[model samples]
Target: MQSPTKPLAYSYIRMSTDIQLKGDSLRRQQQSSKAYADQNGLELAEAFKLEDIGVSAFKGANVSSGALGQFLALIKAGEIARGSYLLVESLDRISRQQVLDSIPVFFDIIKSGINVVTLADKHLYRAGETNFADIMYSVMVLGRAYEESKTKSMRVGAAWENKRKNAGTRKLTKVCPAWLSLQENRTGFDLIPERAEVVRQIFQLADTGNGSFSIARRLNQTAIPTFTKSNGWHESYVTKILNSRAVLGEFQPHRYDDHGDRVPYGEPVADYFPKIIEDDQFHRVQASRRRRLVEGAGRKGPEYRNLFTKIAKCEYCGAPMRFVHKGRPPKGSQALKCTNAVRGLGCESISWRYSDFETSFLYFVKEIDLTATLKAAAERSERATVEQQITVIEEKIRQLTAKRERIFELLTEPGSSTAFIKGKLDECEAAIATEGAQITKLREQRSMADMLPTISADELRSLIASVQDMSAPDIFERRAAVANRLSILVTSLRIAADGRRPKMKGIRTFLESQELNPDERDRLIDHIEKTNKQSQRYNRSFNVMLADGVSRYVVVKSDDPTDIIAEVLVDRDGAISGSDRGMPIGWSDGWDNVFDEPVSV
Candidate 1:
């Protein structure tokens, strides 16, 4: 006859702190469970590995969101076989919750046809067997565990509270930012010069419109070692440094809640660390980041080619116009093509050479009076108006927060409906989120206003002149800097192409009116036909809208790449001016139609 198979037993192990793992906690528990299983003729269920590390059971967190909760759920669903053993080191491993609350969980397991074995005390609560002695023993053990955890939690909380009270005078812990180290006296922090300089360089790069990834790449290329143990710099760490207020010599105290999550507990203390960045520069970097968040952070590459990155759009299908390079110089050239056309989305595939557009735009933009443009923008978005709007939204958020607090108080009242209270809380939270988003948008607007370039008219003109110099060694860098400035000055650039061919009848009439022989007329006719064909290939226009509500309509007539012609039409305060001397006959008509339609910025 075959030997009888042994019963299966699943072991559960838990530790409130991972520090216990460094000692005999894990190994000791494993050995005890193995010994018990071997001695009782039970097979250890290695398949069911249940362990909760760094998980607290004082408030039943282990049973609520940990592996133990999953195991109990499996037992309740009748997945685990009847008469299986759940072996634990002690009752506290299951729960340290108050006896009134923990008794139900303790009894639920036994009632579900599983045996509970406490390896430490060698007690077994078998399935379908209830005894007064077992009940009393479990209650006493659970009660004692709850009291001990409660006392320890209170003591730790009190210690943290005291530390927070003295945070301004002394350092709270040895831990500090990577750029600084706690002093030996334990009263302050000292900055490491090399690391702090790197922090400053990060802020300076950000202020000039470099995003986190760009800054990290630049640092790595220069072989700048990171403050951490990592081999090289990373974008995430760069972003953390950019967003931390610790560089401004401030610290915010935090405390752990009952759920074991850290939350800010008090107002931030000032002058906690050595200041590495000034206030104006810090705010400027923040403003640049916010602007990049809205108007995308443009791509970084060897050549910062696209000046009109997120601002340029195709007038026909409202798709972005991307700058694309076909091949090497002898075979192909860089051009701007509508993304829709490239995707075969029902738009004409007209490629406008970027050289022609850049030259024409810079030549015309130099004629504009930037001082007047800045004044108009200031009038449109007054600082006072933005601040007033921010105040109103903040008040609305405060009222909603108060209302949510009132609803929370009702949760403790007798016979209160939990679902109703939850619904109210959720509604308040949604409203707060909406208002918070509005405030963020308004704040960004104010930041943009603050970040407007503060340079003299001559300096601005010099910058534009430098941007126009394509042969300069640092031309790409110069163009990128000017692009950032233009992003503030210009709101949008709407591009349109006129690919329709010139009328044959009109060409014939014009030729007949001219005094020429048959051969001459034939040659002229052929020339006109060729010009019209070329025009159909590359005749495009742009409607550039300035922040001051001023608009410039630039038409690039690139029938011949070597000798391209451009015309500018300015519309200032409803008055249209600018030379139409060499423009095509009906070019202004297209401009009028575009101006009449609603344009979303």
Candidate 2:
């Protein structure tokens, strides 16, 4: 009645890369599958090892390549063993799609008078016993997971665009020429008080007849270095700084986004960060360009232009005021000011100092009436939003009505043919059908709206402020501020010395007015910290791969990779050295004392 069942079987193994074999990835796994066979009194025979196969799972992980196909082919022909058993080290190691297609294969294997054994999952098959509901549930879960992944991808893309569009004013809090981060929200910048002093000295130098070249030479004589640490400063670099809006006292947002796009610039941060010189010092540089024989042909300003460039309109002309630099001011000094002042567009090139702008900026950044503006914006948003929905419904009705009228006109046209009239009527009929459905949807929306109660002022303000200042936060904070009600306005940039406030526009003015709740901020910080840490590991791993000075190949490390194998190809000049936090916080003591081993790159 039982001739020991002869227990026919085969071994299966896979390794993602050639190097994985050397790491004994397959070798290390075979032993476990073998052990499962030995314990079950089954004999392992032939082996099928698939290497360098490119199909990715990351979903259902309990599949064996060729096993099902071969088994099905054999079973249909009545060729496979009557009581054979299949052996593997568990499912996930074999495939990514664990539950979906695997269970059916398991059913097939059992149908062929076979049972299954797994090493890690400890799965053992008893003939005729299968879990259909569980498998169906798994399918549903996987389906839901896939849907979620798609939704999250779309949401992430949309959020990034939103941040880029609204963050046009983020840079005012960003790193300054002297490395300062002026916003109360930001934690660090390259700014040094001493370096800032040196920049001030540069403006002062240019204010005198010492041209940019002369100023650069004078600067090189001192201990300070340009951003790149060159010995002699260049006129090009000097000109850039004098013309930069940071010196004119404004923070710009949306310098860059997760995906590449030159984000729309932001409004000047209300007087928060300091300016290195007066607006006139910048203007002199501009005038110098115009008065020169070349009409500012070779002149190039700093790359970090403030986001407020076009937002501030010339109040007199009601056109966007342009920032301009002049080399010769009324006082024979360099200055920064609006370009339109003289073009009969507004006023003449008024010379100014980075210092004066910086001082005035401090006041502006500090003085936005956050509460009043936010409340007003909240009201406007509610009104506009509801009205916008109303307009969509009305617009559709009008379109359908227009088509209906056109059909009537076609039927009545003096020489119209019957076929022509019929065609028009058919089109009109189809449009009317679509409009009926749309009208039903709109009625449902309106009914839902009618059922809802209006929010109180405090509640409405809270809702609006929650999404207020979304653009300026860095990668970490920004990711967590996922639910943004962000808005920005770049309406008025430069103001008189005694100007008391920064006029708000868009959503920013509203958020600035509302009182900030620390709890929400902390939640955002936590999410940012977690995600940034993981993303940083990938980035640094990519960098370490660069250090290898080799080609890119798939690599798998066993004992916690010292670094990612792909980063070996990059260099210091490569932008995006890594995630913002390239180096681990506790991995090294400091830049001064770390890496004393004289490592060669």
What TM-score would every model get versus the actual structure? 0.62, 0.22
The count of backbone overlaps in candidate 1 is: 0
For residues 127-241, what per-residue lDDT tens digits would candidate 2 score against the true structure?
A: 4456676445435544554455346545754564455444444432244555464556543233467767777887776544356776787787775666666656788988777
Error of 1 at 374 (Å): 6.8
Candidate with best lDDT: 1
Worst 10 residues of 1 by lDDT: 592-601
Clash totals, every prediction:
0, 89
Return the lDDT, model 1, position 330.
60
How large is the C-alpha RMSD of every model relative to the true structure?
Answer: 11.3, 34.5
